[model samples]
Target: MFSTVENYWIKGTPKEQLMDCLTAYKKENLLTLAENQLMPMKKSHTKSKIATALAEQLRHNFKITVDQLTETERHILTAYASGNLPEELTEPQQAAQATLVAIGYVYLFKENQQITPIVPKELAEQLLENESEKDTDNWFLTTKTTVETIYGRCELSHLVTAWNQHASQPITMSEAAKFV
Candidate 1:
């Protein structure tokens, strides 16, 4: 994982920066995050509680979700590893990124007027810790079917843009799964 400081992607430690970003999220968004974690949330739960719970939960649960990440979502995180922010992104990419955010696997760091999507360095290490070959038969063909179904015949290069510039950068897992 790239250094958040060296990369200038954050102003503080990843955990602190994550909370800062989480607090900026709407309560509804936080609620989505909690639900995604399978954490029971009360209607009266304060935003702080929700965000804090997610941060803490992520300390233990990042791998489970990472294991299930669609290929494009994994690509999104890999982009951050290399500090290569691209110029364009697609709706399906945005949706997948948003889902990852909501799932607490990704954090959006906003500094000096630019928003850069990041995962905690520790989490990034954990993701690469195993460094196994991509599983080709786990879930359904997430990318092939999802992309072709949504944006017919999109080129591989067009789909590789930075995920940070979409509707919002973060977590989710519905699409953004395919390419050559």
Candidate 2:
């Protein structure tokens, strides 16, 4: 997403204008915005009747569903939320990690040749304390609302096209700074 924004700046879009665009984009993509700050990513699945009912209601209202996270994934999410997940993983854990990443329940970042988790600690705590899937769904709603409210104070199709044009190499900071 940063790449998309950078590319826009590269194509004669003013930085201040791009910042405004990003502010608007953030307002529009609440789930993507909350991925880091407001909520832990977890599957929305539950057998509890109340939770099921609530999930249905939430789905209707927010278009978000609670996925039924596997037991292993739940454990991993718990550990990640608590900041206890190890930097190194066993073979099985590695596979589980891959699944979590694929499902968007977790994100991995590469830095200095090392991969790391970008767990939201508070969100993890909420997930760990959730007694039912309804609680989890409620968290999602709260996060969505929060992101919208926070960025409400703040459209990049062309930028994406420009990014595809230069996909072979990263957009340099210097190159990006020109528009600013």
Candidate 3:
């Protein structure tokens, strides 16, 4: 019974808080009523009901049903087994919100790391300057073509042709830069 309750508890809010919210929502129901009017009626299987039904399903499907649990135990077991518990309370309890908030911050930290600032073109240029010959050639060709294309100049084609020729016979950066 303790294991069943603990599993259903979900390591978050107290059962009382959820019960309160469910009770309040059931009473007021102004927004939910309007929304539910548009939505189709759900199958209306409670967690406990579903759990009991699942045991029946297991018996039918697998030809087996465990006999340890009583009717009340079956109801509680079904509810817990389905990993469902009711929100019978009002506004979310502080402890529940705190747990969720902590989870939110973990996600926030990951997002912050992924949101890198755009590296300036000048930085790319500087990085490429000290690289190997092949890297330097690729960088120069890419940078030259990008710059010319963005400026709507027809010189990019000429620059690529010059680069291909220079690759066949090595040339200094100044010499290659002049051709491009």
Candidate with maximal TM-score: 1
Per-model TM-score versus the true fold: 0.54, 0.35, 0.16
**Winner of 1 and 2 under lDDT:** 1
Task: List residue ranges in candidate 1 displaced over 4 A.
Answer: 1-17, 109-113, 132-180
| Residue range 77-132, candidate 1, lDDT tens digits | 76764456556768767666666665676776666766677766667676666343
Candidate 3 residue-wise lDDT at 150: 89
For candidate 2, give the lDDT.
Answer: 0.41
Candidate 3 lDDT tens digits, 105-163: 00001122231111123222322332345465676667777877788664545665656
TM-score of 1: 0.54
Please tell me which predicted candidate would have the highest lDDT against the true structure: 1
- Pairs of residues at least 3 apart in sequence or in different chains that clash in candidate 2: 43-67, 44-66, 44-67, 45-67
Which parts of model 3 have CA positions greater than 4 angstroms off?
A: 1-131, 154-173
Q: Tell me the tens digit of each residue's lDDT in model 2 across 1-180.
A: 222222112222222221222232222232333342234433342223322332233324221211466666666766775668686777777666655543334445444654456433334444655534444345334544565577752112333334446555444434433322
Clashes of 2: 4
**Shift in Å, residue 47, candidate 3:** 85
